[model samples]
Target: MAINLAILGATGAVGQELLRLLEARALPLGELRLLASPRSAGRQLQFRGETRTVQAVSPESFEGIDVAIFSAGGGTSREWAPIAASKGACVIDNSSAWRMDPEVPLVVPECNLEAGRARPKGIIANPNCSTIQMVVALKPLHDAAGVKRVVVATYQAISGAGARAIEAFQEQCRAAANGEAVDPGPLKGQLAQNLLMHWSVDEASGYQEEELKMVHETRKILGDESIQVSPTAVRVPVLHAHSESLTIELGRPMDAAEARTLLAAAPGITLVDDFAAGAYPTPLTAAGTDPVYVGRIREDVGNPGGLQMWVVSDNLRKGAALNAVQIAEGLFA
Candidate 1:
């Protein structure tokens, strides 16, 4: 039987991407429901040459939904996801709402499909966008070399913040090109032609919540209680794709070539390392692509048994919408 699918946050960036991916993959479907907040209700969205009018989402929206892919913010998921699950719909939530819940499995299908099957809450939480690509690239190495620690610096795209941030970046860039003053209230600083270490507001702990999510989510996905992860999340002017420079400490020495071999064989990972030919994965190259691109594979000079690599992926696609849809596909298949 074809699965009946519902897409929450249908008007948002990641939500739109989920529609494109479903169309691209021609996923088996009995019915396709487009849901959005009240503000977006009555809007029309195109899918597979047919225009579907969006309906305001409510608890009743999931009545007959076999699978619901949620790309809405945490608040919406928190309010509606359980309601959907209560009605027998399996929810693949893209927000961070239920990731840490012991009963809600944090899934990255490539790393932990078994955990997905054990979702007692009927909800599976997709890891943070940054965490998803990082874990996909690192999981192979962690298996081959036994990762002990990770230090990551991210060049995150504005799309991770939603569609408004993307528009803000563009407006700021246009003002800069015209030599006009631009207000940076949306980001609290000049985002055009600039970079900032603070991706989101810092909590009382002094670490931005985005960074902390990486630290905690990575440990949970890897199922390693002892692995130490430190992350610095930066918001770049780029509109799509997030890039991370990661240094991973292993329990044993690892040669660069061996590391490359392991990463190349891993699922959902694309190897793009060829520095001599000026070929390395970048956010520009990874944008719109589904696979996590890995490059700059080498040994860390300062730490014994440590390796350095670059990971890049489209935050809206692989990081959010696509990953959530993929999780639903896994369950349905």
Candidate 2:
């Protein structure tokens, strides 16, 4: 069956990716509406060989739309998503505004598809980029050995901040390469030859808001409030993909070899643990890919019941665009 679709933030990065996927895939669509702010209203994007002009989104945008995927920002989602929902569209929001809402389902299709069936608020929240890959890998192990606590450190790409951040990094790189002084915006210092290891602190928890998102979103997605998560999020100069070094403590001891077998067969996860030949998952390897890549699997020497692994995934794909589209598809299923 063909369904009418509306894409909010059509000019944004994730929004553009969603358009590409919608064209590439066999997802049936009745009419596709590309919406953006007034500034981007006249821009044109190609889809299925047709030039579609973006329209300025309004309350009436969702009138006959079946599913609305939003990637604009929290404010837009807060102001417009409910309005779209009220008009009978199922909204898949890719913002932090409603992830923690009791009524909204924060979904990662592979992790929790059933949770997405309810739309009491007519909106489904997507998890943070860092949280998505971590939970996807943790889900299988969590079910087999019971995850108790997790210590994760994420090296997030500048792209996670959006297209402008990547542009800023490029401008800085050009300046530094030519031996010129530069003022890099959106980052503490020159990101070309540096790392923002300590991200801005979240006033409430002293941890970065990025880190807190992982801590809180993980527990909610896993459906286990008791699970403990300590996250340290850092900004790297990379253009794509986010990498995490994870140490997960399980209720029962599981060997690295055993965990590898389970993860190798898990959905949306690819086990790449061939350490002897210098093979391990990295941001470069995972970028532009959909699967969550896990490698460096071993035991945490400090804890007998703990397993250590590295997780890498495209921050834009599985982390953002692909995930939203997956949630949108679940509505049809």
Q: What is the lDDT of candidate 2?
A: 0.89
lDDT of 2 at 289: 78
**lDDT tens digits, residues 183-225, model 1?**
7866767889898765565668789889999988998999998
What's the C-alpha lDDT at position 326 in model 1? 79
Clashing residue pairs for model 1: none
TM-score to native of every candidate shown: 0.97, 0.97
Least well predicted 10-residue stretch by lDDT in candidate 1 = 196-205
Q: Candidate 1: lDDT of 247?
A: 94
TM-score between candidate 1 and the true structure = 0.97
Clashing pairs in 2: none
